[model samples]
Target chain A: MTRRDSFLECEPGVIRLFGAADIGTKGMVSGWSGPEEGHNWNDGVEAACAVAVKPPVTRLMLSVMGEPYVTRARPAQEITLYGNGYRLGFWRLSARAETALLVALEPEWWLERGAKAVMRLMLHMPHSVRPKDINDGQDSRELAFCYRSMCLRPIAG
Target chain B: MAEPALLGDLRERPDGSFDGWCWVPGRPQERLIVDLLVNDTLAISMVAAIFRRDLQTRGYGDGRHGFVLRLPANTEGLDSEALITARERRSGHIFGRVLRAAPAVSAPGGPALDRVERQVDALWQDLDSARPPPEAERPSQRLRSAFGTLAGRLRAQAGRAPWPDGPPIVLPAPVSPALTVAFVARAAEAAFARIAALAPGLALARAELLVIDPGIDPEVALLSSRVRNLRMLRDGAAAGVIAACNLALAHGAGERRLWLGDTVATPSAAALLALARALAKAPPALWLGPEAAISFADVDAPLPPAVSLPARFGMALCVDRAVFAELGPLDPGFGAAHGLAYADLALRARLLGVDLRAVMEPEPPTGAAVEFAPASTAAWALFRSRWGALDPLIAGA
Candidate 1:
C-alpha cells in the first residue's frame, strides 16, 4: 500500500512544519477524497450537530482559519466530525488511517450546487498518543499529538 | 520567521511612563507590524521598518528591524501595574514574555474608588436612619452594621480614629518583576520552610516571597536574611490579614501580586518552572492556580487551562496590580478571621471582565485542602451586594 502526507505549522509556541508532497492522485490527497456521493444517512437532520464520516482518516487534527464548518471534532469509536451547520445527517464513508475530507462550506449542500472543493484537508499523525488517552474522559478536546495546521488547495488539484 | 528580541528592562519611570526598544527580525519581503499592548489591549501600533545596516554587515540583508516604543502617562485609569506586551500586529501573538510596569496613576474617572465608598457610606446612613428590624434587615443593611463594627474595632484595637469613610485603600505596586508571592506570617513558619525546601533557588527567581510579618519568627527572619529576595515588611502594629495583603501590595514592586495562605505547602522548583512557563503565555487578565493535594499534576486526566479546582483562603490568588488600583481592595470591613477576602476579590474580578483562571501545575504541591475562616454573615452580605447571586459552593463554604 502506498502512503501519502501533508501538514501545517502553528506558533508563538514551538510551531514548526516541514516536508510537503503533492499526493493528488486523481484529486484524492491526504485523506481528503473529493466529494464522494453521500446522502442524508440519518433521520431528522434537524437536531443533529455532527456527521459520522467514514473517511479514510483514522486521525485528523488542524486549526481552522475562518469559521469553517468543522473547526474541531472528536475522534470517537464512530469518529464523529462536527456538522458544519449544514445539518446534513451522518456521512458514512470508508474509514482509513490516512487522508481527510473537509470543506469550508457545508459539503452536501454545496456539492448539490456542483461545488466540488473544500478549503483544506487536515491529516494528523496516527496514534501518536496512547490509545487509552484518546477516550480518557468527557472533556477530550485535545488530541495532544495531532498535526497543528494545514493549507488549502483547489478541489481539482 | 526569526522571533523579535526585546533587549533592556522595560521599567516604570517615576512619571508613570514606559520606554523600551525591541529588535524584530522578519522575512525581508514581509511587512511586520508591532504593537504596544497594555493588559493585552493595544495602546499603539507602528509599521515596523524591519531592516538594519548592521545585519547587512553580518551577512544577508533580511528584515532585522529595530524599533523603539514609549507609553505616555495614563490620565484616566490609575491602574497600579500595567502588563506591557510587545506583540505582532497581525496574529496578535506576542514574541516573548510580557513585561509589567506601573502606569501613570491618573484619576479621570470621577475617582470611582472614592465615589463607591461614599455611595456605600450614604446607603449605610440611610439604613441607620430607618432602623429596620435587626432580624429582618437585607444584606446591604447588614453590611452597614458590619462596617460599623469594623469602625468600632479600629477604634478599640488601635485606639485611633475610625477608618475614614472614603474608600478601600488601593496599594500601588512599587516593584518591577511581574508578581510577588505574598503571605501573612504568624506562628506558622513551616509554610516558609516548605517554600525554602523547593528548588529554593527557583522559587525566588521570577517572584519574591513577601512575608507580611506582623511579628517575625527567628527562623523566618533568618530565612528572609539568607534568601536573596525575601522581603519581611515591618508589620509591628500587626494589621489584620487583609491589611497585611494590602500593605504587601503597596510594598510589592511587581506589576502583578499574589497571596499565599500558610495552610498549603509551597510550590516546588518544577512547579515554579511550570508557573514561569505559563506566565510566558501572558495569561489572560486574571489567571489563577490552586494547590493540588497530590505531589504531581493531574496529567493522566488533565483539565483545560481555563477550568480548575477552586482555591480556598490563598491557594495562590494572583491578580494584576490593577485589581486593587481599578476595583478596590478586599473589603477589610468583611470581618477579620472569616477569610472570604480572596473569594470576594475573585467575584469582583469576574465582574471587571477578569475571571480567576485555573493555572495547571505539573509539579503541584501536596495538601490541597484549605481551612476557610468560619462563615461570616457579614462577609456574605458584602459579597452579595457587590456580586449578585453568590457562587453556591462559596456561599456554603
Candidate 2:
C-alpha cells in the first residue's frame, strides 16, 4: 500500500479544461448542430464547454472539441492535446477520479457513448491511478497486450 | 358490507335549489339527514325522506333516496363560490366535495346584449328624426343617428394629434376583434418559428402579434414581419429582454396585454380568447399562466389554487396596460444580471396588490426564462441584496 498523498503529484491547470455537463436541450449546443438534426454526444461536449470551462479559461488555449474516456479499451492513457499546447493524459476509473470525472448523467451512464470520453476526464499519473477493475465491455486481451509495452511507472511500495 | 357513500353527479336546479340522489338501498326509509354547505362555512342541515324510485331499473343503491335543497339566496353578497358537502347522518363525515363558482352578472342581460339594445333604441330614434342628413353615419361611431355623429368623430380625430414620440400604438385596431399576443424574442430560433406559425389563427380572431427582437440580426426581424398582424421591433444587442418588453408595452394598444414566450406551446386562438374572457369576468388581475408558478405560502411547495394568491413567475402572463404602468417597469437588474427578473416583478406586483391569478393547464412550467442557468454564487448575492428576506415579503403579502 502506498500513501495517497505521495501517489499523486498534482499541478495547477491539470483539470482546468474539463467541466461538468448537463443534458442541455439535447444538442442545442452553441451553433454546432445541423439544421434538421439535434446535437449528438460530440457536439454536447463542445457546447457544454462554454459553461463548463472554469474562468481564466479565457487565458488557456480553447478547444471546442476534446477526447474523454476509453476508446476500445486502448487505456486512453496518453492523449495528444492541442490548442492549449498542453498534452492531457487521463487516468480513468481512478480512486480519486470521482472529483475529477464529469457525470453527464446519473448512475455513470452518458448521453452518448462518445460523451464519456469528451467531458469526463482526470490526469493520468502512471500507476498511482489504476484503470477500472470491472470489464469495460472491451476485449480484455487488447488491454493486456497494449499495457505491456508502455513504460507504466509502478506504485511505490 | 355496506358503508356510507356519496355517489354520482351533482346537479343544480334553476330555482336556486340543488337536486341529487343518495340512499342506503334495502335499508329502513327513515330520517335522511344531509347538509348543504355554501363556501364551506354556511351549512344548512335538513331531514329528507327516501325519494321513491327503487322499483325502476335498479341503479347503485335502492334508488329510494334523493334530496332537493333550496339553497338560501346569496343575500350576504359573498362570491358565488360554493362547496356542496354531504355529511351522512350515521357517520357525520363529509362524503364528497363539489366546487362551483357561479358567474356574477351586472344585470338581467349580459353586457353585449345591453349594448345591442341601446344601439337599437338609438336607431329607432334616428329613424324618427325630423332632420335627415345627406349621408348615413357609421354604425360603430353612433348608437343611433350615424349622420349626426360623423361630424363629431371627424372633429375628435382632427383635434387629437399622434403620439409625441412616434405613431399611435393601434392594437386590435378600430375593427379588430382578435386579442393581442406579445413576447420578447431572444436568440432561440425554434421558439420564434413556433410563434410565427400561430399567426394565422391569431389573425382569424383579429388578434395582433407583437414580437420584440433584441440584439439579433436583421433577418429575424424581417422573418417575423411577413406574418399578418405581426409587428417586430429590433433593438440593438445591448438591450436585453426586459428593455424590449418595456418597448412592447409602449406600443401595445390592445384591450388587454398578454406576455408569452417561444419556450411554451402556443395556446390556440380560442384558448387565448377564453383566457381574455375569463379575466373580463373576474376583478382586474395579473393572469399568470400555469407554468412555473411558486406558491405565496411555502416557496418550496407548489402554488396550489387553494392558497397561492399571486403565483410567482410563470412562463406566460397577461396584464392590462393601465394596470402594468401603475405597477411600474420590471426591474432590469435582476433580469439582465441575475436572471431573477420575473420573480422580482411578481413580488412587486403582489406588494402593489396586483392579484396574481393562474390559468390552469396540464404540465405547469417553472418559467426558467433564460437559455442557461447563471453562476449560482453571483446570482444568490444579487438576489439577497435586492430582496432582503423572502419569507417575510411573501408572508406579509
Candidate 3:
C-alpha cells in the first residue's frame, strides 16, 4: 500500500484522475460511479480530497452525506453533496480543503477488471492524538482504551 | 454671596410724570435719547447724526451709549402680545413667553395697575392650589419597625449555620499539561467522533481526544490513528484523566479552553467560536450557553430565556487560564467517574465572592442529551436545602 499521497500541485478547476493500469480495460466502473451518474461519486471523492490539504485537519474521517433508502427491494444509501456549501454542501466541502481532485476517471473499471482496477482513495490526514502517558488503574485504563477504539470505528464499513 | 441690588429710585416731576434716573453700571456719559414718546404711540431711534452741543463736550463716545426709555404708565399692565411674540422667537419655551409678557410690577399708583395685580395674584393662587405636596406622604414610624424585623430574621437564620470559610479555595493553574475524560466506552467513541466531525472546520490547531482504551482495543487504536493530535492514555485513573487533561491544557497553545461532550452532539465550530467570543468579554464569574440542561435541572420556575448569574457549570464551557488560577482544579473527590465536580466548583466560586453568569448561544444541538436523574435530584435537593435555610434572611421576615 502506498504510504499516503498529498494533493501536490495540480491544474485548477480540473480534477486529477489516477486509475490503476489494469483499470479502464473493461471501460465500465461498477455500482455508482463518476459525475455523469446521478450518484456523483466523483464529487464525494473530490470533497474528501479537498479536506486533506488544510491545517487543523486533525482527523481524516468520512460520514455519508444523507440518509439511506430502500432501492429495488434492497437498502441503499442516498447521498447528497454540496448542499451545506453554496451549491448545497459544496461550501462545507471546499472550506475544509485548500483544493480537491476527483480520484476516479473511469466509471465501470472497478467491477469489470476486479482487483487490478480496484482503487480506494482514503483521506491521508494524521490522527488527532496518541497515548502520551501510561499511568495507574489497570482495569479502568483498559476500559478507557476500549472506549477510544470504539469511537474511531467506521459505522458503515 | 453678594446681596441682591435694590431697585433704582424713580424721580417724580411736578406735572405728575416721572423721570427715573438709575445708576446702571458700564454706561457711556453721552446723553442719548433712545425714545421720544408723547403717548402709547411712540417712535424710537438712535441719533449719532443729531447735532446736540452737550453731547460733543465729552467727545469720546464709541456709539455704544446706553439710554433710558419713556413709556406710558403700567407697561406691565398692557396687553403683552409683543413681548410674548419676541420671547417665543428667542427662547421657545412656555416659561420664557410668560416671563417676557408679564414683567414684574413695581410701580403702584394707577387704578389700571392695581387691577392687573389682582388678576396676577388670583392666577398664582390657582396654580399653587393645584400643585401636589413636594413629598409623598409615607408612614415614617414603620421604617424602624421593618429594619428591626429584618435583623431578627437574619439572626435566627445564622443561629448555628456553618458557611464554608478560609478564603475559599482558589483553582490553581494545572502544574501538568493534560485532560482527564472519565466516560464509558460508547460515550467515549461518541465524544471522539463528535470532535473529529467538528475538526475539519473548527480551525483549531491543537485538540487531543484522550480516550480511555481498556483491553488494548484495536478499534480504539485504529480510531486514534485516523485523527491527528489525538492521544489515548490507557490508564483510566479518573484522577489521571484529570491529570492528563491538565497536561494537555497546560501544553495547549490555544488561547481558550473547552470541556466538550463526547456522546453529546454539539453545534458547529462556528457556534463554538461564537461562544468563545461571547465569553471573551470576560463577563461575570460564571459563563454558560443554551442547551445546558444541567442549568435547567428540575427547576419548574422556567429559567428566563437568558439570565447572567452565577450558577451550575455543564458541558461546553470556555474559560480563560486566569479563572482556573483564581478558582482551582476539579475536586477529584467527586468520584472516579464524572459527577459532582461542577456543583463543587460553582459553590466554591460563590464562596470566594465571584459572581456567575449564564448567557445563551444560538443553534445548539437538540434531542442529544445526557439524562442524569441523580444530578437533577441532587441539584433540586441542594436548592431546596439552601432556600429553606435562608428564606427568612432573604425575606427579611
lDDT of 1: 0.41
Give interface RMSD, every candidate, in order: 15.3, 34.2, 50.5
Q: Among these predicted structures, which one has the highest lDDT?
A: 1
Off by over 4 Å in 1: A1-157, B1-175, B188-192, B198-205, B216-225, B287-314, B337-339, B358-373, B388-397
**Which is the winner by DockQ between candidate 1 and candidate 3?**
1
Q: Predicted chain A of model 1: TM-score relative to the true chain A?
A: 0.22
Residue-wise C-alpha lDDT for candidate 2, range B1-397, written one tens digit per residue: 2442433223344344565544554454433456665655634444333233532245544443555555546424235334455565455645433333333323333344445646767766676464554455534335443532432233222332111223222223212232557776554344345564555446455565666766442224323212322355555454766676666654454556667744556666555544555545555655555432333331333544432322222335666655676776766665454235555666677778776654434533343222223435554456556665654442233
If the candidates were sorted by their TM-score against the true structure, best first, what order would they fall in? 1, 2, 3
**Model 2 residue B34 lDDT?**
61
Task: Give the Å shift of residue A20 in candidate 3.
Answer: 53
TM-score of chain B of each: 0.44, 0.44, 0.36
- Cα-based lDDT at residue B322, candidate 3: 50
Better of 2 and 3 by lDDT: 2
Q: What local lDDT score does residue B205 receive in model 2, on the 0 to 100 scale?
A: 52
Q: Give per-residue CA lDDT, model 1, range B37-91, as digits (tens).
A: 7666656554343234544454433423333344535422334333455666566
Q: Please give, for residues A66-115, the per-residue lDDT of candidate 3 as tens digits.
A: 21222232222222333113222211221221232212122222222321
